[model samples]
Target: MSTCVYVQLRCRPGTTYDVAEAITLKEIHSELYSTSGDFDLLMKLYIPTGEDVGKYINDHLLDVPDIERSLTTLTFKAF
Candidate 1:
């Protein structure tokens, strides 16, 4: 089974669009949403089995610029 994670990103001032564009360019996320509140963007990612979750986030998601903070939610099973 694939591993799924939800990431919420807090972007630097006036940089939400840039950050979201970068993420979209990667073609990695299953879904992305612009949100109101503490986070500027929410992304849903699917990682293939045997991939390292931490490393994937660090290498891909975290590399985007203008991301000031991130919150990751790991999923187990779908009901």
Candidate 2:
């Protein structure tokens, strides 16, 4: 089974758009968007079985410059 994770990202000041664009360029996140909230952006990602979510966060999400913080929620079920 596949796993879906939702990530709320807080971007560095004035870097929201840049960070969103960069994440889009990476093409790893399933869905990404800039939003108006406590968090600057939101992203959804999918990982195959046995894959480490932390590794993907560190290697792909964390690697993006100007990203300040992230909150992740793993989905248990979907309709």
TM-score leader:
1
Instruction: Write model 1 residue lDDT over 1-79, tens digit each, in one string.
Output: 8899999999999999999999999999999999999999999999879999989999988999989999999998768
What C-alpha lDDT does candidate 1 achieve relative to the native structure?
A: 0.95
Off by over 4 Å in 2: none
lDDT (10s digit) by residue, model 2, range 22-75: 999988888887788899999999986888988878887899999889999988
Could you tell me which residue pairs clash in candidate 1? none
The regions of model 1 sitting more than 4 angstroms off are: none
Clashing pairs in 2: none
CA lDDT, candidate 2, residue 17: 89
